[model samples]
Target chain A: MSKTVIKVENLFKEYHLGNIGYGTLREDLSTWWAKVRGKEDPNSLIGHTKTITNKILESHFLALNDVSFEIKEGEAVGIVGKNGAGKSTLLKLLSRITYPTSGSIKVRGRISSLLEVGTGFHPELTGRENIYLNGAILGMKKYEIDKKIDEIIDFSGIEKFIDTPVKRYSSGMYVRLAFAVAAHLESDILILDEVLAVGDAEFQKKCLGKMDDVTRNQGRTILFVSHNMSAVQNLCSKGILLEKGAIQTQGSIDEIFETYNLNTHHQQCIKLDERIDRTGNGQLKFTNIQLINANNQIINSVLPNEKITIRVHFRINKVININNVKINICIDNFYGARIAVISTDNDVNFTTNFNNDFISRGYIDFTFPKINIIPGNYTIVLYSTVNNELSDWIKNDALTFSINEFDYYESGKTSANGHGYIFLDYKIK
Target chain B: MDNDEKWDLIIKPAGSLNFNLKELLHYKFLMYLFVKRDFVTYYKQTILGPLWYIIQPLLTTLVFTVIFGNIAKIPTDGIPTTVFYLIGITFWGLFSESMSSTSNIFVTNAQIFGKVYFPRLTVPIARITSNYIKFFIQLVLFFGFYFYFLFFTQYMKPNLYLLFVPLICIQFSIIAFGIGIIISSLTTKYRDLQFVVTFGVQLWMYATPVIYPLSNIPSKWLWVFIINPIAYPMELLKYAFTGQGIVNFTYLGISFGTSILLLIVGLFNFNKVEKDFMDRV
Candidate 1:
């Protein structure tokens, strides 16, 4: 077996939430030291200083707590997590862009990270010059960049504009060129953070193929962090899932994915008002959401060819006259790709009666004629706008349901699982 | 202690004051590229381009000669007025540029520094390196005027003290870089210091005897010159070129020692800050 190339022990990262530069170093360090030793803070017990001490002690929260992991050489590991899950913080620590608050990480070789593409790019410089500048920033020697210049330019597919200033290139061209340079980095370990989310679908596929080649053909260890599970499942053999600054699970990619899905699925039945991860103006708020069938029966799951009705109950917290209201429910697959968007504005203005006068509290029902989604778990986003301004929005996990498999043509045949996420009508002669 | 296992790198919460010369040396090419980028982009879209380097100081020299020499009647210690002020401007210009640029290292490079990892010292060192080139250009221009007075006007007496010119330049770069990093480290927390840098250099120029001769200062107030690290080397440059200024060996020694000490403090603070500046920046 290959030796462990990376080892992290009892890592902890804590961030102060409020003002950071107010006090002297001695005061901050002493207070921090006292707290780290689990002793009463030096300022906490003083008479008439209780408020100051509370502010000092309550000002920080841990971003990562007692996290530890090890990776062997040539293992492609995927780090999966929700927002603020400490995944980016872990990547930042590994890349040495920032140091951890405590603990130690030992590594055996040079590590290159693509935290952001074209990190040091100068727009005044031509694309060729930026290549060298960016390459040098990534720890490549001049001669190394010289050797790979032609290959990088060709891979970017913008050879004709290589000598032009990058400020003149379109955003697409810029991202392509930047990713092209980063993809050619020669290092024993590569850490990536959602760098493939840019560019069009074709270029994204090309980047994925190149990354696959990097891991499989070149045998380099990779630590990838992304919300896109399908890409993670495609590239990584090992997986590590993080939740709220702690590791949820670690094992094979399939097992980890199953664990992650189960966690998201558990949140499906949660009440909308109880969901704290929502953002909107308090003028309107979604209170509850339910899925019902054609016979007016509430259901948690639906069949492939069934009529589905999504009823969204909301409350008006403040009295305000609103118009041009649009409500959209976007259904996304497990991979975070949008499958369909059902909007109230698709057919006609449904709120003509309440254009001038608004309802204080009521429910809006959206009924779909037929849902032909494939058999899999999916999530939906709840969004609404009043007069082209966002009034309420609840992103993924606003509601989640699984599609039951059924024979649409009644021939006892099921569609291939990996082909697509939707079913449409067609008949063979 | 895990003596059996050896890893290439070990990262901890706090870093040491140890200077990693090998690591800095390994990134020499990056320093070179930074210097090159600074040189190329300094005047990229301008009409005069590099010519502006010469034009800026000459204009400042002319203004100083008129105001300080002819109008204020400041003595040049028998050296020609134009050459005296030009030499002072050349030296002071480089020193101020190096100091200001060094101090702004954290604020300017915060974008790249936050995302990538390399020697943070390289950026400031590269700024000083490139500033030296601009200094060199202005030095050559000063020489052109010096030779004109020496050979054509015959009002100059030169000596072998000119050999100290390179040493003076090196000391200026070091002192500027040292002070710059210290201020850069502090400014990451207190941004008000950044506003102080520009006028601070201006005030520091007056203390260094850039526009007047050191001989004009009263003997009782000369201790400020003794402590100002740029004073001796800058005085030495004028004395070296014209052989007409004071050169005290003890004060020069003290200046050199202080510069080295300042650099150590700067490096210590800079190393401590660079590891986690992103959080604060």
Candidate 2:
């Protein structure tokens, strides 16, 4: 009878980058002592402190928070997630590259992982030698490698270049040889992380076939992670969706994939304010359901790095010459942090004639200069006042756009990082 | 497939220092391949290449003769200063090489650690073995000089105690790996210690009996030399070869016992690191 091969319970893991060079030994010892007693690390849940932009943030984020699942012998499981959704983090834990901050994982058979392409290949070694060397790294013995040497070479289809050093091989050749070695590993359970899509169409099909054989004939369990939805739905019996370090759902392949797709929609709206009542008195109301452009479209929904025009129109019923008025607009990101602001001066003192039969027909318009914000959600806020008294304030949650790709223009940027969120271009060169 | 056989390979990542020798034996071939990679890649891109293995001891011995024998006129316990320093440097370098190579095992191999899983200690264990090969190469050069001096020189003579050289080599291996594992485990989290250890070996050479004879250390602060386990082996080398220096039995026992303790503690921490060192690193 087949067995339940992989069992994982309440597995959790986290990582803090940049500031990791201290306190590792103390952490190692404490974790080691805890594991020996069959107890989880006390500090694993709290995790290490994270730092960003010279600010040490006290909030600890779980890269993989209390995730638990299992695969029966010969069962295939697929994991799907968007960026920063902890998909890779979970594979790392199951592969034992890092221990879980909490929980336990038990595998009752030999486990081999192709977590990254060419993981243990040395450039100095020959393709022939690297096949042996990498096979060893994958936990195959010299004699076991001897038996599969010809098969690995033939499957790779690079026998002509097999005697040359791997540094001389093209990237396609390198990945082919790497996948060949890992695919031939005889372990009872295999875990692959985004490695099936290697070389071209033929190579990927070959790798998929090898994985299929391992599961069907050898009764080996496979946990596969990939961005290809069709492959996940076709190859796996079970599916899991991870979102922001927590498990969103796990179920039948069709069920989890649908759930995964729905949760990954981009949220670009920045601010939640659509109406304004200044001075805490609900006296003056400004409700156009967010300021509209001349076409009456949602304003401020254009690209961040493009010139944008913001226009607001209003109506009045009082007979007054409102000559002391200014329109102020503030910008912010989706996470509720203010970035920039713009306002026209009150020097002009443009008069708005309000009479019993008067209808305000003009709109305030401002052209936003060279936009430099990255691709994310942002908000625009508008304010109107007369004679230094606040009359109306309105903030709108409009989805701001961002463009990708950096063509380096290194003529005069004081802070010339090769790539970052903002680009300061001074000249074409 | 029952629970009895499934219970094999118990990994106690924390607490005690015991290891599963049977599992290590099962993975012996993997160990051999790692050693091969280290030895080959190290000598890959050089002009003289593996010959540097023999050349290092030869060149260092000549420099020792010029500096200590010709300039400072330091006594070599009646042995040739060139031979004395060569052997001392060879043994002392073994300890330092193992320490620095393995001390950053977690940090230096973060890429491989992140991508795959093998026995975690295999790298350090392979490091010690490769250094042992280098030690053997230097030993051959030391014996070549030993034979030449005995036949040609009048002031110095070879002693029968030279047979104990193999035992001294083992002691040196134990000492090197003990210190290295401790440093390797610590440096996984505290990385700059790797830089400190690189030059730390250089500074430590001045404190050990590498360039100077053990007897030449001041009698006023004799206990200072006792902290370095290399001192006992160096003094033993002098006594066993040229029939000079004290071979204190008490000090030798302490050096041997301390090496075992350090290996245990170092392995203790190193095993804990194996679980998720790649994550933290």
CAPRI category for model 1: medium
On a 0 to 1 DockQ scale, where is model 2?
Answer: 0.40
TM-score of chain B of each: 0.96, 0.90
How many residue pairs in model 2 have overlapping backbones? 7
lDDT of 1 by residue, A172-248 (tens): 99999998899889999999888787778788788778888988887899999987898898889999999888998
Interface RMSD, one decimal, each candidate: 2.5, 3.1
**Where is model 2 more than 4 Å wrong at Cα?**
A14-57, A264-429, B1-18, B45-47
Error of 2 at A129 (Å): 0.9
* Candidate 1 residue runs with Cα over 4 Å from true position: A20-58, A275-286, A292-297, A301-310, A314-331, A338-359, A362-376, A381-396, A403-429, B1-4
- Most accurate candidate by DockQ: 1
**lDDT per residue as tens, model 2, B1-281:** 33534622322223335565775776788788888888888799899877788898788778888988899998877777877787787777677777777777777788888788877778888888988877777778877887787678864545776787788777777767777877777666666667788778888788777777778877876776677777787778877776777788788888778878887887788877677566556
Candidate 2: which docking quality band? acceptable
